[model samples]
Target chain A: MKKVLSGNEAFARAAYEAGVGVVSSYPGTPSTEITEHVSEYTEIYTEWATNEKVATEVAIGASLGGKRSMTCMKHVGLNVASDPIMTLSYTGVNAGMVVIVADDPNMYSSQNEQDSRHYARFGKIPMFEPCDSSEAKQFTKDAFALSEEFCTPFYIRSCTRVSHTQTVVDLVDRVEGPAFAPENNIPKWVMIPVNARRRHKLVEHRTELLTELAEGDKYNKVTMRDKSVGVVCAGVAYNYVREVNPEASTLKLDMVWPLPIEKIRKFSESVDKLYVIEELDPFFETEIKAAGIKVEKLERSLCGELSVDAVRALFNGEEYEVESDNSLPFRPPNMCPGCSHRGMFYAINRLKLFVTGDIGCYTLGLLPPLQAINTTVCMGASIGMGHGLDKAAEGMSEKAVAVIGDSTFLHTGINSLINTVYNKGNSTVIILDNGITGMTGHQPNAGTGCDIHGGNTPKIDYVNLIKSIGVKPDNIRVVDPFDVTACMETLKEETAKKEPSVIITNKPCIFADRTVIDAPYFIKEDKCSGCKICTRLGCPAILWDGEKRVAFIDETLCTGCHLCIKVCKFGAIEQRSK
Target chain B: MKLDILMVGVGGQGTVLSSNIVCDVALANGFDVKKSEIHGMAQRGGSVVTHIRVDEEVFSPTIPAKSADIVVSFERMEFLRYADYYGDNTTLILNTQVIAPPSVGDGSAEYTDDKVEEVKKQFSKVYATDAISKAIELGNPKIAGMIILGILAKAVHFKKEAWEQAIKDRVPPKTIDLNMKAFDLGYNI
Candidate 1:
């Protein structure tokens, strides 16, 4: 049967059809849907691990137990899981294992635009890149088989364009992989120094065999069209090339890593001119050049995504003029109308605290109006960075604070908290407990009291977790983030303390819990004072009438959480009658 | 023959769902379809766009610059945002509604009425309507996107039955009637 599917969805369907027994992942954009879809198949045991490292370890454990296993995560998540993947390359898997890493070439929902192909090369594993959803399914199934054949873990690299794009895919029945009996080969499974040294030799041998396999037409294809111009591309870039220059000779690499060196050289020789086209990094171009092959080095921006227009412009020797109007107002992503993080960030901004922010929805706090967050390096870096900032700067103890989301706190902030306590750091850490992973479409985490399958699970108590890690019970305070005054007072009290403090802002994300939204708020024109205090909250629902010099709420956009009402000192803003 | 439809709107204006319906209509009409849109941060009240291609054979999910056969926008400002995507032959179906961004709210930017005039002067074939108000008259403001899709349906050569079937397949069963009414309201406009 043929069905429309995104690249992420295709990967999930392919994994199920390939009879994958175990699937694990942490939610991240462009890749989160893979595991979410995998959970629908009852035959597969799926989970939302606390972080990518844990997810990778779980899949690794399942692979070692003689079952085909898969783990999916975004490009940055691969960094956290890389420790295991780099070593797992040396210690080959017992069963077929595939790591699906979706790269955000344009940094769409990612902190960095690092290419996952580099990871495949760094870990010495074969990587496959699919152009569209159809290829995504076929490559995933082929990747699993190749992994088992080579006795190594394989990488399937997807970008935002491919993963988020939907196209037709052909579905097939479940073809269960060959089952393996558990074996206790210490030298093969264990990665101690002496054993790892021997396993390293096997890794090199596997690479050679994979390179030869890549050289064949199975993984790499050469389209002999007009030999005047040749294009070497992979993943979504191939689609753009095909869209614009279909008449040109093309060398599309389905297997990006372990690139067929001889095949590339032959393709270059076949055409009059060879052009390497790929998004972000010039991995293929650099490698082809290093192989001593002469290819045209086109000057293109290494930033953002490559599009059909970009390819046309490249061949025409002109720039792709992005259709954009500068006069149009910039519409940056903002906090929702009744966002739970609003009041807390409002208080933090009032306090003038130097906040070390972590990844999540709260990262938006760094933008305009309520610029509360000072630094956002990565997941769970807020606590450690805050602690380090306080230790380095003498007078920054009271001014420094760390803000993290509940899901992210559970992911890695807990480790940073333990380090902070052990090192006697005096920084205050605030956990924005919105009950769900608010950023990547609200996936359940360890603290959310739910599993990937929507089954109930024990919720992690932040207070007890913090206390057990040496923080005093009195130092941990739970406050309602929606209540602006209470949030402000609690923050002020915690930052003044010399000891390490943990503040938990308890409120469900408005999108997660619509029950919190009441009647929409409106402003009484008679009682209005045009002080713009409510506007400082930067609520998307609140707009200022410059002519009237008063603020009015857009009832359509308002969630009616009464946050703006609290900020309005004058008796102007009132809840609309239901 | 290839048809490229570019849908632009605010994040929550249902561009994704509308584009999905367009793809479904194309599929029901026996055409190959590919659709592409960015998710995540762009979903939070930011500018969102979807590129959809329907043809005998579709290569790139994204439409080439200035080659969009039809451009449907859910808001006035958003319609003007992608001026580069419009060619002389491009037909524009725009919703006459304005959702001011934070910059406009803060007085850092101006969203003037001149934008609507600019859109009228630039595009040769323009179909502009208050779809939001019409949707609200139909009992729900959210169906404005459906109304825009209805206008889009008239621009294409597909049969009305294909659009109805696509809508029925895409929407919830309970609200199918309301959505169909909204679509018809747009179709007649």
Candidate 2:
């Protein structure tokens, strides 16, 4: 059967067809839907792990228990799972294990554009890259065969361009592969110094064998068109290269890592001019050059994504424009109009506190109206950084605080929160529990009381969780962030305390929680005192008519939450009656 | 045989949903289709764009600049932002709706009043619709994208049944009637 599916859906379908018994992932953009789609298949037991590290570990345990297991994450997520992944390469697997990592080339929703192929090389694992949805499905299925063949973890990399793109894919029936029984092999399973040292040699030998297999693999193929220019590309870049210059001879490598060394050399010798067409970093170009092949570098920036026009320009012997802006007004992502974080951030800025922000929708607080955040290193860095900053300076503890989302706090903030209490750091932490992971399209978290399968799970009580971490019950404050006056009062009270404290900003994301009714708020022009205080909240619903000098709310956008109404002391903004 | 479409709109405007419907309709009609979309933070009121290409055989998910056969814009400014995607050969189906960006609304910049006129002058076939107003007339603002699809249905030679089926397949069961009505309004307009 032929079906139109996104690369993510195709990947999940392919995993099911490959007889994958266990699938685990933490929700991240371009990668979240893979796990979500997999959850639809009852044949495959799937989960959204607290973080990528735990996801990788769960998949590893499943693989060791003789089931085909896979874990998925974005490029930055591989950084979190690198510890286990590096060792898993030595331990190998009882059943085939595939770690699917989606890279965002343009940093679409990610913090960085680090290549996942580098992780494959670092861990001594084979990596596959697919150009379209069909290949995404086919390569994913092939990944299992490659994993079990070498008894090593295999990486299947998808970029935002690949994962989010929809294309035609041919569906296949699910294959029932032989399941291995868990055998207690002490030398192979145990990673003690002696065992690890011997396994490391096998890891090296396995890479060599994988490279030999890749040399003749169907994924690494050559298309001879014009012998003058031979371009080597992978993943989405391969599509760009093919579309732009179909006449150019091409060496397309679906198996990116443990590269086809012999085929690359043959292709390099056959063509007059060899070029590497890839987005972001020159991963293929650097490696092909190291393999002693003479290649010409296409004049393109390593930053951002490669467009079809960019590749076409290179093929047509024209210089691609470095910068071409039509002067469109910038539309950076902002906090939603009725977002609870806006009130909490507005309070943070009013108090002039240095806040270490974590990854989530709240990180948007670093933008113009509420420039409240000082640092945003990574996930769970907010609490750890808050403790460090407070200890570094004498009075910084009084002025500095940490803000993290419910999902992110659950991912890594719990450990850091426990550290603050254990180390006796007096840093104030704010857990912005928006109920779901808002940034990644509202995936259910531990606090959301729903699993990946949408089954009702026990919700994590933030107040109790904080108390268990050794903060006093009195010190842990639960406040409705939508109530600006009350939220500000709580913020002031908590920062004044000498002991460590937490203020949980409890509210659900308006978009995610459909139960939240949004009665339109209209501005009373008669009572308007053009103070522009409500405008400072940066609510998209609150529009200031420059001519009238009075603010009016766009009824369609205004959620009856009415944080703007509380900020308006002049009785300007009022919610209309139901 | 090739129809390259570039759909641009603000996040939460159902731009992704519209593109998905078009792709599905094309697939149902036996055309090879590929579409590239942006989701995530962009879903939070940022500019969202999708490049959808359909033909007898489609290779790339993205459409080349200055080569789109048709440009379906849900918002006016976002359409102008991607003006590079269309040329003289391109037919523009613009939803005459403007949701000013923060910079423009804050007096830092100006919203171009002559955008429709400007686009008309550049592209030969420019169909501007008051889809936002049309959607409001139909009693729901969320059906604005469906109205654009109605206009697009006229520009392209696809079966109305296929388009309707695609909409039904993609949208929530409850909103199917409203979306079909919105699509009909757009088709007529």
The iRMS of the candidates, in order, is 1.3, 1.5
Error of 2 at A43 (Å): 1.6
Best by lDDT: 1
Per-residue alpha-carbon lDDT of candidate 2 for residues A267-350, written as tens digits (9 for 90 to 100): 989999999888887888888889898988667778888878888887777877635345766888889878878999998888
Q: What is the per-residue lDDT of model 1 for residues A1-578, given as tens digits with 9 covering 90 to 100?
A: 77678898999999999999999999999798899899999989999999999999999899888889999999989999999999999988888999999999778788988888989888899999999999999999998889989999999999998899889888999988779766578998888999999999999999999999999868799999999999999989998898898899999999999999899999999999999999988899889999999989687888888988888888888876565567768888888889999999999998888999999999999888999988989899999999999889987879878999998998888999999999999999999999999888888888888898779999999889899999999999999888989998988888899899999988899876779888899988878889988888999998988889888889988888888878888889988898
Lowest summed lDDT across 10 adjacent residues in model 2 chain B is found at: B104-113
Over 4 Å off in model 1, which ranges?
A320-323
Candidate 2 ranges with C-alpha deviation above 4 Å:
A316-327, B105-109, B172-176
Please tell me the interface RMSD, in Å, for model 2: 1.5
Give the per-residue lDDT of model 2 (tens digit) for B1-189. 899999988887878778889988999999999999988878888888899999998878888878899988788767777767887799989888988787665545667767656666788688898888988888988788889999999889889999999999989999999998999988887
